[model samples]
Target chain A: MTRYKAVIQYDGSDFLGYQIQATGRTVQEEIQKALTKMHKGQKTVVNASGRTDTGVHAKGQVIHWDSPFSIPVEGYYRGLETLTPDDIAIVSVEEVAADFHARYDVSGKEYRYFVKRSPQHDPFSRHYALRYPFDLDESLMNQAARILEGEHDFTSFCSARTDRESKVRNLYAIKIMPTEDGWIFSFSGSGFLYNMVRILVGALLYVGQKKLTPAEIKVALDKKDRTALVSRTAPPQALYLWEVFYEKDNKK
Target chain B: MTRYKAVIQYDGSDFLGYQIQATGRTVQEEIQKALTKMHKGQKTVVNASGRTDTGVHAKGQVIHWDSPFSIPVEGYYRGLETLTPDDIAIVSVEEVAADFHARYDVSGKEYRYFVKRSPQHDPFSRHYALRYPFDLDESLMNQAARILEGEHDFTSFCSARTDRESKVRNLYAIKIMPTEDGWIFSFSGSGFLYNMVRILVGALLYVGQKKLTPAEIKVALDKKDRTALVSRTAPPQALYLWEVFYEKDNKK
Candidate 1:
């Protein structure tokens, strides 16, 4: 079998999610269907670095698959581009070693959350950014984001549906940059739990609104309880999987 | 009765057109529905400067309507904002003279056509731009646009369905501005016929592609025949009703 890794980009507006479900359209299902057709009805499965929730876009998601036919990289890319839907694009593809598993070899991940602070909603960009009409104190949001950085138990910032036993994860950075309309929050970490990024953004926004203090956010992180968070989870449309980082040799 | 003139914006990706038809969703129907609800079930009619085809967006389309209630400007704006769909927005509104008519009193109009020159399709901006993968000669397009400018009979660039008795219109300017990705063609004229802007764009694109010479375009315009042109009409999704102008004293 020939193993190949690929970088992918997709607009998740109409997709159920990145994973295949019992019903509804999904990014994985589309990609797999394209692969099956290329393989002449042979089943083809793909593994990704992680699954993104519904309406969460991706600019540099990574995936890998083993193919029985050893085709050129350009041929594979062209074939997938012709078969898959327009919303999902294979940015680049390359051959990889047999043991280079897409999910298992992941080292770090980066996510971005976009918020539009314009008082009037932009109809064209409604599906791409979350509109926050009210004023937000950036200094307070930055302080709260600083407190959330570093290794800690993020149970209060994770979803209740997660089955992982350990809630501990190390966050390398949390940067907030202001744009013309609003702000973009960037989070880099070793790994994230289910709904972790959305929950963290929700907590930070509460801090910016002065409803919750930075000290309160620290206390909630220490509590290690999902119910401790008072803020509602942020919507999925504004979140994006920016990029995935692997070992130096495996980087693309 | 109080007459009001309003500037509007809408994302036309899901809309059938700007006019109310026998079936399908339309921007005008949505606005009129809001007005009827505000008038307590009484039907309210609205007249726009012009009609936009299916999937054509607008940044500054103008409309006028007469209302029985003389509410404050803010009240009317807020009511419309609350009642209309998220894709439509009321940018500004004001009471206009009773003698003013939205359709007949227009002095000029501006339209913008967006073309994406990138070889790859942008998944996020699929509805906002036309992706033209082939190389284009900007100078050639500009030469053709200049020839088409000024007062001329534009029968070659007009739709056959238009019933207007005269096709002679004075075009003030046709500017081709290069953007990061592609080019934006802006047309300013006294008025345009059905699909005039799209047809002009198609003919210019043909010039840029070297499929038709600039001299041939001049000949087609002089022929005053719709079938004289070889290029197809451009798609509607990339066209925008950029702005509408009125007499200096009636400007809002």
Candidate 2:
């Protein structure tokens, strides 16, 4: 079996999530269907580096799949491009060894959350940004974000639905940058539990609004209980999987 | 009656145009209906500087209306904010003299057209930009744009269906600026004939592709016949009424 790596981008507005589900449309299911059609009715399965939630976008999602046909790397991209919808684009495809597993080989991931603070709603940009009319103190938010970086037990920030045994993860960076009409919050981590980034964003927003102090975040972390933190989670629409990184010389 | 000047913005994807029409929803009809609702069954008439065709967006469209009630300018904005759908926004409302006319008092107008040259379509921005995959020489297009500046009879550029008798208008500026991922063409003029900007964009696109030379545009302009020029018109989705200018001392 030949393995290939694909770099993908998608507008997740209509997707249920990255995983296959019985009721709603999903990015994985659509790609699998497209691959099956391309392989002359043969079924194909793909493994992604991460499973993004519903309404979450991606710019550099990585995936790997085994195909029966030994087509050149460039041909795979062309095949996928022809089969996928206009909302999704495969930027790159490359041949790899059989051992390259998208999920197992992933080393880190980056995500960004966009907030639109304009008083008037921008109709064209409403889908991609979270509209918050109130002014946010970015400096305060940044200070809170600094406390989030580094290895910690992130139970308070993770969703209650997360099934992981250990809540410990190393948050590499959390940066806030001001945009023309809003702000962008970027987070990089070794791995994220369910709704971890969203909850972290919510906590930072609470601090930005002066409702919570930076020290309160540390208390929440120490508590290890989800209820210790803010109940609100940022909406999925404004969150985007920016990139995924892997160890050098990986099979795929 | 109190006159109010309103600055408006809208995503025109679902509208038939700025004018009220029998077939589909129009920006004018939507705002008028919203105003009527706010006034408790009293109809309100609004006059704009000009009409935009179906699928055209606007960022700073200016309009004026007279109302029987002396509502605060903020009240007008807030009322419209609640009444108008998510696609439209009344950015600001200010009281003006009774004599001010939206159409007649305008000194100049600015319009912009966005063209996406990338092969891949941006699904999120599909409704706001025109996607053209073919390679275009932007420099050649700009050279042709200079010829379009200044006062002239734009009979060839105007739509054949236009009812206006006067085809002459002063084009203050015609500029092509390169964006990060695409091209933005801007036109500022005293007035524009029906479909004039779209036709101008079409001609420039043709010139950029080398299908027609810069000299052919001048020839087409001199011919003063719609058929003499290429009939291609840019899609209305990419066009935006960017701004409107009026005399500072004008009462309304």
Candidate 3:
């Protein structure tokens, strides 16, 4: 059996997230079905660095799968390109050791959320961006982002239904970059809990609107209660899984 | 009565072009309906810079409309903000002379066409871009574009159904700029014939693929026979009316 690592990009608008559900379309099921068809009755299981929710997007999502055939690494690209829908693309592929795993391997991830602050909606950008009509103070938002960095129990920012018992995680960095079009809030971390990035972005957005001060973010962090943080979640369309980094010399 | 010149932007995915059509939704009809809604019992007519085809987008389309009431220019912005659908936005509004016309007094117009050269289809970008899998020689495309500049009778490029009597027009410039993501084709012209821009882009694209040569474009121009030019019409989604330039102090 050969294991292959694939870097994928997808527009998650028409998908019910990455995982296969009983109802609705999914990215995983579509790719796995394609693989099964290509292999002629051989079942295939695919794993990803992380599972994204419905309506979310990804630019550099990484995944791995085992195949019965001894296919060249380049063949994986061409095969997936032909099999996957237009909304999904396998950007790159490489063969890995038998033990290599996409989700289990040691690594970190980065995510970005975009918000459009203009009062008038830009028809061209409406789908990919979250529209916020209120005026935002970028400096204030930047100040709030600093509080999110470092290791802490991010219970307040995580979804309440997250199955993990340990809510503590290390946040490597958080930066808010203002662009001509809008603001991009980027977060890098060892890992993220369900809806953690979206909730964190929501809290910072409130700070930018002066609904909450920079100090409020610290209070929310210290409280460690879900209700302590801002409840409004950023729209999934504006969120994107940007990259995944893994430890070198690790083979599948 | 007062007239206002408004700069508009629209996605155009759901619009049947800028003209008012009997059987389909149109940008002009939508804007007029919005205006009539705001000024109850008052009918308003809107004149646009030019008519755009179905699925063609706009970023800086200019229009002029007369109103019986003297509405503040900012109110025009706010009113449109409330009335226009999410797919349309009034970027700016300025009071203009009663004689000012959106289509007649134009000095020059700028339009852009986008082509996604990658093999992968982007779900988020499906409504706004044209994807071409074949490799295109940018240098060759630029060479063909240069030949399209200056005045010529573009009968070979215009749609057969175009209602214009004279097919001669001045093409101020045709520039193909390479962007990090895709190619940006910009055309500045005094005026354009029906389906002219799409045909021009199609021809350039064919040249880029080595199917046609720059010299062939010159030959097509010289022939002036509609059948002499390439028949493939570029998709409308990739085209955008970026700007309409008029003389300053022209009171428009």
Candidate 4:
């Protein structure tokens, strides 16, 4: 069997999430179904860097699977392209080492969230952005973002449902940049807990709205309690898995 | 009664068409439903600048409606905002002269068509752009567009189902500009018949693909027969009613 790693991009508007669930459409089910078809009735389990929530999009989600057939990488790409729905796209496929694991081998990750700063909702961008009607102070939001960056316990920002034993994560950087009519919050880190990026963005937005101060965010982080942060978790539609970084030497 | 002229915008992926038909959900029905609800059971009729087919989006579709209540223009805008779906937005609303008619007094119109010139389809833009998986020569397309400009009988490019008495309309300009990953074909004209913009774009794409020469397009125009053009009418998803121009002296 040949182990192959592939990069994927998807518009997650219609998907329930990235993982398989009891009901509703999902990204994993779509890809696995396509693989099973290509393999001719044999079930093929695939592993991914991580699963995203419903309405959360992805630009470079990574996954790996073992193929029983000796098909060229381009052929696999084409097969998947024809089999999967239009919303899912295989960006690239390459043969990987047998020991390579999509989830365990991940060195870092990058996520981005979008917020539309207009008072009125834009019809064209309603599905892709979180429409915030109120004014936002960009500099305040950035200051709050800076306070949250670094290696720290992120229990305050993680989802309550996260099953991981360790809530400590190394958050490398957080940058808020201005787009034409909105702001894009980019986060790069060693890893993220369930809903961590969305929660972080929500907290920063509170800072921008003057509801919470930068010092208040620091206090919330020190508390390490999910309830300590009063901000609502950011919605899923505007969130995206921008990239998953693995060890450069191992792959290239 | 105060006559209001409003500019509306909508993402037409979920809409059947601009006109109120016997069956599926349409932009006109959505707007009219909102108006009826706002009027408290009094059915309010609206007249649009023009009707667009299914999956055809609009950036600045003008409409006129008469209101029985004495409400401020901003009040009308806010009312529509709270009543309409997220995919539809009221760009602006103002009281216009009673003589102003949305359909009859139209001076000119502009339409835009997007073509993704990449071989691979982008999942994020699947609803908005036409994924043409072939290389196209920009200069050739522009040369062909230039030949189709000016006043002529555009019956060949008009849909055969159109019931208009006159098919002779002035096409003021046809500009094919290159976008980052594709091309934007902008059409500005005195008026257009059914499917004229889409058919024109289809013929130009044929010219770009070398299937038909620019001179052949001229002959097709002279033929004034819809069957003379072998190209297919471009799909509605990539088409947008960019703007509907009116006489400046009437309204600013």
TM-score of chain A of each: 0.97, 0.97, 0.96, 0.97
| Residue pairs in collision within model 4 | none
lDDT tens string, model 4, B206-239? Answer: 8888899898998999999999999888989999
The regions of model 3 sitting more than 4 angstroms off are A41-45, A69-71, A116-120, A131-143, A178-182, A248-252, B20-25, B41-45, B115-143, B208-211, B230-232, B246-252
TM-score for every candidate vs. truth?
0.95, 0.91, 0.87, 0.96
List the TM values for chain B, per candidate: 0.97, 0.96, 0.96, 0.97
Interface RMSD of each: 1.0, 1.9, 2.3, 0.8
Listed models, DockQ each:
0.73, 0.47, 0.53, 0.83
Clashing pairs in 2: none
**Alpha-carbon shift of residue A188 in model 1 (angstroms):** 1.4
How do all the candidates rank in terms of lDDT, highest first?
Answer: 1, 4, 2, 3
lDDT of 2 by residue, B183-250 (tens): 89999999999999999999999998999998999999999999999648888999999999987665
- Candidate 4, position B40, lDDT: 87
- Model 3 error, position A54 (Å): 3.0
The residue-level lDDT of candidate 3 at B169 comes to 92
Clashes of 1: 0
Candidate 3: deviation at residue B208, Å? 4.5
| Residues A1-252 of candidate 3: C-alpha lDDT, one tens digit per residue | 888889888888778999889989999998898788777879898999989999999988888888899888777788888888878978888989888888988479999998887766788877678988897898898888777899999999999999899999999999888888678989999999999999998888889889999998899899999999764888898899999988866554
Runs of candidate 2 with Cα error greater than 4 angstroms are A23-25, B14-16, B20-25, B116-120, B131-139, B248-252
Error at A219, model 1, angstroms: 2.0
